[model samples]
Target: MIIEKGYDLRESLGVLWKNKNAAAIATGLVATLFSTMGPGLIVMNAAKSGGLTDAQAISWLLGIYLIGGLSTMFMSLRYRIPVVTAFSIPGAVMLAKILPNFAFSEAIGAYIVVAVVTLVLTLTGVMKKLVERIPVPVMLGMVGGVLLSFATSMFTAAINMPQIYGVMIAAFFLSMAFKGFSKKVPPIVVAIIIGIAALGFFNLITPIPLSLEIAKPVLALPTFSLRAILDISIPLFFLVIGVQNIQAVGVLMAAGYKVPINAMYVVPAIGTFINSLFGAHPAVTAGPSTAICASPAAGEKKEFRFIAAFSEGVFWVTFALLAKIIVDSVKMVPKEFTAVLAGLAMFEVFRSAFEGAFAGKFRMGALVAFFIAVTNLSILNIGAPLWAIFLGLLTSFIVERADFRADKIENSEAIEAAK
Candidate 1:
C-alpha cells in the first residue's frame, strides 16, 4: 500500500511537471499580474484621496498584495483548484468613491465590517443560496457585461499606440492560427514574447531599478461609524458577493469544474476578514485570473490542470516578496502592450460568456441584463450586477407568462376534443 501510494504521488507530480509548460507559466503570470493592474491603481488612488501619506499608501498596497498572495496560495493548495483570490476591482472602484469621505481608520473599519458581513453570509449559507437563485443566463450576462470593457480595450490600445499594439495584435493572431500545430504552445505566451521583443526593438522598454524588499503588513484598529458602514461596507459586501464571487463561480462552471460553492465563499470570507486587520481590501475569488487558470490551455488533463493555479499562487507569493521588482518590471512594459495582452487573454472568456448568456430560453431577459450590466448602471448606490439580476428576472416572469398561458390553452383544447 505504501509503495502504491508513493507511486501515485510520483505520477501526479510527473503529470504536473510535464503539463507545467511556458504557456501555463505565462498564463499564471498574466492572470496574476495583468488582472491586478486596474485594481492596484484604484487602491493607490483611493489611499491618496483618503489623505494617506505616500508611505501609508504604499503600505496599504503592499498589505493587500501580501495577504492576497498568501490567501490564494493556501486556498489553491487546499482545494487542489486554481482558486485565485484578489481584492475586488468593483469594490476598489466603489472604495475610491467613498474612502475620500472618511478618515483612513474609518475606511479600515469599513473593510473589517464588510469582511465580517461576508463571513456571516457564508456561515449562514445565505451567500450560497443567493448565488444558486440567480439564473445561469442572467449570471453569464452579468459576467460578460463586466468584462466587455476589457475586451474592447484591445482596439482602444491599437488606436492609442498603433505601432506597438499592432505588433501585439498580429502576434496574438499568428499564435492562434498556428496553435494547432503545437500542443505545448499557448498563443498568449507567444503574444507576450512578441510584445516584449517589440518593446525592446523600439527602445520602449526601460529597466526599472528593483531590489529584494519584503512588504510589511500595516495594522490599523477599526473605528466604525454608521455612515462608513452604510456607504463603504454594505456596497462593498454586495459587490464582492454579487459581482466577484458570482463571476468566479461562473468562470469555474464554464470551464467544466464542479465548484464547491460553500467552501469557496467561506475561504475567501475568512481571508478577507483576516486581511482586513492588516489594512488590506476584501479578498475574493478573482474572475479573469481564475478563468485563465481554468482554461484548457493550462493542461491537457482536467484533473492535473490544478498545477496551473498552484503555479499562479507561487507567482503571487513571489511577487509579494519581490513586490518592488515585479511591479517595476510590469511598469516598464508599455501600457498599450499590457492592454493588448489582457484583451487577448480574456477573449476566450468573453466568447464563452456571450454564448452561454444568449443561447437560452431567457434570451430577451438575458439581453436586458447584459445591456444593464455593460452600461454599468448603478442605482441607489448599488452596483449594476444586482440590478441586472433583479430586472432580468422581472422581465422573464412578465414576458414568459404569455407562453405559459398559451401552453395551458392548447392543453385544454386537446382535452375537450378527446372528450
Candidate 2:
C-alpha cells in the first residue's frame, strides 16, 4: 500500500480525526517518552561536554526536537504513513567524543557538509534504490542488532531497581493477560500508571514546582576545518544515513509497509540542514519510534498507523516549544520507568526483526550482523550498525554465492519476461 495521494487539507485532517484511538495514541506517547528520557539526557550531556552554555544547550534541544517533530509530522501526514524521524543517537555520541578536539563552529561546518551530501543522494535517489536492493534478512539482522541494547536495558534497569520495574512489569503483563482490557487501556499506559503509583507509594517521588521556562534558541555560525571534516563529517554522514536511516527503513519494510523511500531520505536531508543551524544533530528516520508506530499494536487497521507518528510529532513539537517545562516534567519520571517502557514497547519489533533475520536466507550473514550490532563494536568512531551491514553483506557474498546467483537469475528472468 502506498501512502501517496494528492494532499488535501480537509481530507488529511479528517483522516487523522477519524483514526484517533487509545492504542495509536499510547504507542506515540511511549515513543515520545523514550525520546525524552535517555535520548534527551544524552543530548544534554553531549552539550555539556562540548562546552556549550545553558542557552546554547537549550537551542540544541530546541533544534533537535522542533526539526525532528515537524519533519515527523509532515512526512506522516504528507505520505499518509508512519514516517517517524529523530536525531541520530550515534551522532550525538560521536559529537560528544569529537567536540572537545575541535571547535563547535568547525563541527557545525561538518554538519552542513554531511547534510549536503545526504541531500545530494536524496535528489539523485541513489540511496533509496541502493537501500531497496539490500536483502531483507541481512537488513533485519542489523536492525535487531541495533535495537538489542535498547531492549536489554530494560531488564538491566529492572535488575538494579526492582521496586519500580517489578510493579511496572507486572502491570504490563496483567494488561496483556486480558485482551479486552489491553484493547481499551493499552498495556503500556497501564504499566506507566502502575509504575507511577509504585513510585508515589514508596515515597520516591520528588515533586517540583510547575513552571514554564522559555527556551530561547540562539543562532550559531559555522567555520570550515579540514581536520574536522575528516574527523567528523565523514563518520557523521555515515551514521546519519548508513546506520540511523537504515534501521528505520529496515523496520518499516519488515513490517510490510510500502515505504516512500525517496521521500524518507529527502525529508531527513532537509531536516539535517535545519537542525545543523542550531547545533543539533541530523534528523534521520527513527527505528524505535517508527517501529512503535508501524507495529500491529498501533491499531487493528494498519491504514491508521500513521496517526501514531503524527501524535508522536505533536508530542515532540510540544516538547520543543516548551522545552524547559517538558524536560523538567520528563525528569520527574524515573529513568528505569522510561527504560522499561522502551524495552517493553520494542518486544514486538524485536521479535519480527529476528524472524526476518533468520527465517529464509542469509542466516549466517544476518547472525554475524546481529552479533556485531549487539556488541556495539565501533571502528574509527563508526557505530556497530554500519559494520554489521557491511560484514553481513560480505559474509553473504562469500559464503552464500548460490543464494545470490538464484536471486540474480530470478531478477533476470523477471526482466526478460517483462521485455
Candidate 3:
C-alpha cells in the first residue's frame, strides 16, 4: 500500500470514520486506558512520595499525557503506522525510587540529559546500527519473554475471579468463533461488552462522580548534578532504548511493518526533551499499548490500521484535558478486569513473537532468550530484555557456528569433486 506523504487531519479523520468499527474503537479505548490511566496514577503517586506538591504532580502528569498524545498523533500520521508513544513505566518507577533523595530540579536535569543523549544516539545513527545488528530471533525472543507473564496472567486472574473473568474469557473465544458472522464486531469488542456486563451484574464496578478540571502546566528549570546523571539519567536512557524501543520495534515487526529505527527514536526523543521541561518523564514508544493499535482486530485493512492509533491519540489528548474525570472513571473499574483485557489483547502478539522467535535455525538461541526474558532478571541495573537478546545472540553464535562451518566445508568438497 502506498503511504501518503504528509499528515492531513481531514484525511485522518476520514480514515477514522470510514474504517471505524467496534474493533477499532475497542482497540483505541483499551490502548488509551492502558497507556494513560494506570501509568499516570503511578507517576503521580510516585511524585507525591518524592515530595512533589499537588500542583507539581499534576504538571508532570499533564505534560506526559499531552506530549504523548501529540507525539503519537504526529508519528502515526507521518509514517502511516501505528506508533504509540508514552512515558516509560520503568523510568517512572525508577524516578519514584530515586526522586525522594534529590531535588525535583535535579530529576528534571537528569531527564534533560537522557533526552540529549537519546537525541545524540539517534542523530549519530548509532542506535539504528545497533538495532540492525541484533538478530530477529533474539529480538522476538526477548519480546515474547517480556509478554509471557502478561499473557499467562489471564488464566491466573480468571481463576482468582472465576465468575467475571471466566465469562470474559469465554466471551473472547466465542467472539473469535463468531467473528466470521459479523465484520463490524471483533472478539475484543465482544469481550469488553461481556466484561462490563459481568461487572455490572456482579456489582463490582462503582460509579465515579465526574468533575472537569484543566491541568496547569508548570515548568521547572533543571539543575544538573553528577549524582542524578549517574543514578537516573544513564539507567533511564538504557531502559527506554534497550527495553521499550526494542519491544516497540518487535511488536510493529511482528505485526508486519518495517518501521524506520531512526524515525522511531527521533520523534520520541524530541517529545521527551520538550516534556521534560514541564517535569515529565521521557516519552518512549509504547509497547503493550501499541500492540492494540497494530493488531489485526484494530482494522480489517492494513493500510488504514493507523486510524486506530490516531483514534487512541485523540483519546489520550481528551483524557489529558479531562484528567480529573478520566482518572476517576478509570479507577471505578477493577484492576483484574483491566489485566484480563490487556492480556487478551496481547495474546496474539505474544503468539506471533513466539512463533517468529523459534521458527527457524536459531530455535535454541531463541528459547534461551525467551526464558531469560520471562525471568525478568536484571543485572547491573539493566533490564532483562537486553541481556536476553545479548545472551541469546551469543548462544546462537556458539551453537550454530559449527553447523555453518560444516556446511561450508561440505560445499567446498563438492566443488572440488565437481572440478
TM-score of each: 0.67, 0.70, 0.64
What is the descending lDDT order? Answer: 2, 3, 1
Per-residue lDDT of model 3, residues 1-419, tens digit only: 12224558667666667766776767777677556534665575467559887667777877788888888888777777888988777567556556777889988998899888888878876775555443556656766776676567678989888889988988888776765532345566677778888899989898878767887778889999887776667657766786677678778877777565677787788888888877888999988778878988787877777877877888888877666554455467786776677667655556667776777656788888889877865566555665776788789889876534553454345334422
Query: Candidate 1 — which residues are off by over 4 angstroms?
Result: 1-65, 76-113, 180-186, 218-260, 277-280, 286-311, 330-334, 373-390, 400-419
Error of 1 at 285 (Å): 3.7
Top lDDT hit: 2
Per-residue lDDT, model 3, residue 179, is 52
| Candidate 1 similarity to native, TM-score | 0.67
Q: Per-residue lDDT for 1-419 in model 1, tens only?
A: 10011124355556667666766666576676555544555565456447666446556667667767776666555555666877776565445445666777887888888777877777776765555444556556765776677667788887777677877787778767875632345666677777788789889997878766776656777898877776667656765776677777767766666566766676677777776776667888887778878887775666655677767777766655654444446667766665576567666656766886788556677788778877765567655665666677688778865533453455345334422
The regions of model 2 sitting more than 4 angstroms off are 1-61, 76-114, 136-153, 183-186, 218-260, 286-312, 330-342, 345-349, 374-385, 403-419
lDDT, each prediction: 0.66, 0.75, 0.73
User: Pairs clashing in candidate 3?
Assistant: none
Model 2 reaches what TM-score against the true structure? 0.70
Positional deviation of residue 358's Cα in model 1 after best superposition, in angstroms: 2.3
RMSD in angstroms between candidate 2 and the native structure over all alpha carbons: 5.6
